[model samples]
Target: MMSFDLIGRLFGSVRDRDGRADVLEKLAQHEPTLPAPRNPSAPEELLPVALATKVLAGWLANRQQTLVPHTLNFRVLGPAQADLLLAVMAAAIQADGEIDSREARQLSLALRRVGAGEDEARRIGAMLAEPQHLGTLLTRIQEADLATHAYAAALLAINRGTRVNRAFLDYVSARLGLVPDVAGSLERRYRA
Candidate 1:
């Protein structure tokens, strides 16, 4: 419920704007409402694979700019598609018994592009700096049979504005072998 509301507010500029330029400008300068990381750091160990996957999905969905400053032309990818890509990358990085420092750094930098301040980046870095924690995270994720389903739910939450469709939910549920009840719950909760 909180995420649903937050997602709407986060996209309010795009939804409320009458001009495409204004929408794009607002998106370029969008700031997160949550307490995000200021820098990449070892965070409170994110033990749950499902939860971490969800967060990763959200991060990818909200990506609006490159890490490099003064770069004008934003990517043409939609939030849903982008979220899927990030989930894939994150899943791969966490699959092995290691979380590559370079990848973590890249992810942190990418997050910073979305308005994570120095302190927040450091906090995020702390969350990711530990390979061992990442290993455990992956293990937990592999053990949770519903990780893929959880990821789909996160994606739905992020894309609730424009494309909340039954077809998407059914496809994700089938792919992840989610129970009908759980799939239905996610659809009900996340649909715009």
Candidate 2:
């Protein structure tokens, strides 16, 4: 419920303008809202699995909507969809030929947030370790909403630091059939 409310507030905040900074601030401020698991020894003590997934999904949707509204919808994704998203992100992170430490760390954090065990996360990582035909994967996404959200996730993962992975981004965008300007806008927002 708290996650749902947070997502609603996040959507409202981003509706009028580019509220990415605001959304990030809210995510940081509201992380404490996620309840701890019943098992004291659980790895995800800082954030609940469901809540974390919702937060990530909301952020992706917000990013997509802010940059390209027609293709993506701002909504929380279910667990299966989250797994697919993680796979896409993993592929994106590896798109540049080598996985940077920061990108690996980010991917690990995302996997943990979805409550993926080490083996499961490794499985997902292995599945995407090789260069993948992003267009084929995009087609398997079923819904336009998920595909767009996955695109946003890929963009977030790939556009790190001073240099942008333009070639890789362009390839994925072309595979996804995104307008050049929309993909450029998403890249620019992160670059700024």
Candidate 3:
């Protein structure tokens, strides 16, 4: 099941103000505790569940599926995949030559959400601090699920729709051996 919070974010920000409220209300029926986005910046937080919401949205788009908002659950990534996602997400943010404070914070929260251990987080941190080879980092992944999740996380981490990210995602999808449409689908859906 998806987390109600994540679901709320998924459905909440995609529409106009009244539409957003209607969706949030539907979500609140499932999760009474769901708070409206605190401020206008919250269209982003309208998915404060941001990373999860956006990531999950990408996942669904990839599979051409949908879910019940109330019965949602966030998939917890395993340690290795978590590290890969962190690296991928971090690299995506860094691709434009700088990491915005907000972008870094989203990945940090994702790191916390992934439950990456201290040593692992430190290692990934060191890795991120250096230059990255997007292709090389992806070579060890042989699983389709990991590839998809990694792509989604990286796509979500894009600060804005920069050309650098477009290129980076193209390279990442090729490295991960995803169907070419995966990156374009995600970019069109989320980043567009």
Predicted model with the maximum TM-score: 3
lDDT of 1 at 111: 43
- Local distance difference test, each candidate: 0.43, 0.63, 0.63
lDDT value for model 2: 0.63
- Give the TM-score ranking, best first: 3, 2, 1
CA error at residue 25 for candidate 3, angstroms: 59
* Model 2 pairs in collision: none
Candidate 1 off by > 4 Å: 1-143, 148-152, 160-166
What would the TM-score be for candidate 2 when compared with the true structure?
0.46
Q: What is the lDDT of residue 138 in candidate 1?
A: 32
Summing lDDT over every window of 10 consecutive residues in candidate 3, give the lowest-scoring window.
65-74
In candidate 2, residue 16 scores what lDDT?
42
Least lDDT summed over 10 consecutive residues: which range in candidate 2?
69-78
1-192: candidate 1 lDDT, tens digit per residue = 557765676666445445446544564597646755566354555457568899788867643222211221114334443333344334434434354455455555544443434644454344334432333433443455434434432332232232333344444456556657555544553342
TM-score of each: 0.23, 0.46, 0.49
lDDT of 3 by residue, 83-162 (tens): 67667776787788988777677665655554555665576678778887766667655443467667766766765556
Model 1, position 71, has a per-residue lDDT of: 22
Structure candidate 3, residue pairs in collision: 1-72, 1-73, 2-72, 2-73, 3-72, 3-73, 42-46, 45-48, 47-50
